[model samples]
Target: MARVLIAPADTRLSNLRYGKSYNVLNNMTADDVTIDALVGEEETAVEAQNVHVRELGTQNRLQYYGRSFRTAAREIRAGSVDIYHHMNLSYRWFNPVLLAGIAADTPTVLGPCQTGHAIMAEEFNNMLSQAVGYELPLPVSNAVYYPMNAVRDVTIDPVRMSLFRRTLEAADRITVVHEEAREAYARHVDESKIDVIPLGVDAELFEFTERQDTQTLVAIGRLEQRKGYDVLLDALANVVEAFPNVHLDVFGEGPEEQALREQAASLGVADNVTFHGYVDQSVVRDHLARARAFVHPSRSESFSLVRLEAMAVGCPVVVTETAGAHEMVRDGKEGFVVPTEAAEPIADALLELLSDFELTRAMGARARERVERNYDWRAIGQQYVDLYRSLL
Candidate 1:
């Protein structure tokens, strides 16, 4: 019976509501193998035997200390955990954990959720500066650029870069979620030690449902500039002239929500676009079941579960070529990918899908087939299990 320590970024393991990513670890546990999580304080009792919820004061941020890290490492060592998987960004506060894991001779695995090398390296610098008030050399290259209110300038911080590399150095292996991420890691690390395991979805949950024939399109993502809602709106301004019946449902909430709403009005397509802000996950599924197609125009993404979810439910997808969604969605076979931020091209792609019902159905069916064949959760979970075991 192998024991594994799964460390997540936040209080997700307890909240099944947004714990979709837990599929990899949660379902892979066996009767003999004990699964434990290092989670936040608010999490309720986890079903695993070795749950360690970090107790934080009113500040709500768990302060990491060498003593505490060593204590936890001692417990895991006593339990004889076969593997330690780091799922969180490489924060300097937890640097002691990396040291302790090494001291205890536990093989560590870093789960590169996106473009690991560039993103983690940048995040490493930030955590290091905040925790130590000094700059250090970054060892990895895990940088990700998406337009968010937090980092609007489109640059990864150097401090984050340092911390990310330190963490990468501690890991025995790294797992990338997509080909783009793998390529990004290859630029910094030995390609032999990095592996690609794309995110999987519950094919059953996103199974096909009866949908309306109305010329309605849906897009799901956080309401941020990187998501390209503004680009979609610009494209839609021309689309409505050709098909007045066309409508759009944008599903998400973020700092740019009001601005995007204003942009839609400015484009004179406000009436045609519906803002269904951040619906509950289940409700979002219900909404997806009713849409004719799913549209994603993000400038960048590691991989989009939204696309898999829509495809699992037999909805054809239209996305931009620049996103990681390009890797999973085949052009013209399961979905269509167009040029990024090119309003005319997007409008043309959308129109092409809307004008041909037979093509739409075929695309939707092919999308579902692709997901079932390659991205089911059980298959993905076993892959992680095998990866974990190889290091042991």
Candidate 2:
């Protein structure tokens, strides 16, 4: 049996960020594999049927994940484990500092991760401008925060790039969540060393349900700039003009909640939309199970697990080109893929779905079938097992 050390970014499965990582961690069970996983638990080790889990951190705080990687680098039983699999993201401040010192040295895997594609200055400004409308109050506008993030992004780039470059140098194999992420990393690492293994879904957990053909569109994501709740609201306003009874349900909450609510009211779609702040996954799955369509109008995103969940629940998705989730859909077959940050295109796609319920039902069935065939966690875990064997 080959021994493997898997370091997940988080194990609590509390927030949406770690959903994919947690699922992948639990499902990695093979007879020839002995899994040793570092979890988010401080004192208590959670039960996994096949994994021997331990804790290296008190909790999965924002700063803790980076610190956890730093901890993992410093402590490892050299040559005891066959492969060192850094199952979370690798591009961080101190993540690659001593990354190559793990068990078995050269046989290491990093990521199934992503460093989001660059956002141009012009694009950032335009997205914020659209999200923050004409009535710009000092407190209401998110414009001020953008400059801070821009400076942070600028300052962090060289450090992260240098660290990531070191990570590429040390990693024997690297995995990315999507093809775009693979392409982005290929500029720095050898393309042959990189693998595109997307985050998979459990079709059983998110079972297929027939769309009830209501004039309802659902979107699940944090109410933040990256998730593009602003663009969705703009499209909802237009969608309401055509189908006055159309409704939108948004899940998750963030710093942008107030700004988003104000934007919805400004667009005159407040009455048509409900902001359900930070609901459990079951609630999100329930909404996706019945909605006519799922629209994700993100300005910039590398991957979207929510889109996968929506698809698995038998709802077609209307995602923007910037989202990696668009790749999962065969345009017009599963759902329409629209341009990023454009309300008209999003609205147009929704209108088509609403116009023909039969199209949504067909698309929903296709979406579920595609997920079962291509994105099942059972099959995805097997891919990782294959990679581990290849390393050995």
Question: Which candidate's TM-score is highest?
Answer: 2
**Worst 10 contiguous positions by lDDT, candidate 1:** 140-149
What lDDT tens digits, residue by residue, belong to model 1 across residues 272-358? 999988778787787778777898987766567778888888888888876366679899998798887778888888888888888
TM-score of each: 0.80, 0.84
User: How much lDDT does each candidate structure score?
Assistant: 0.69, 0.75
What's each prediction's clash count? 23, 0
lDDT of 2 by residue, 1-392 (tens): 88787765453543243366666766676788887777666233334466677666455344445565665655454346577777766444334434444543547888787766445443454435444433344443346655657687678677778877777767788888877788788888799999988888878989999989799888877666777788888888888988999999888776688998899888888999898998777888888887999988777776777778888989999998874655688899889998886889999999999999999999999999989988887778778888998998
What would the C-alpha RMSD of candidate 2 be, to one decimal place? 5.7
| Model 2 misplaced regions, further than 4 Å | 8-18, 42-48, 60-77, 90-94, 97-104, 117-156
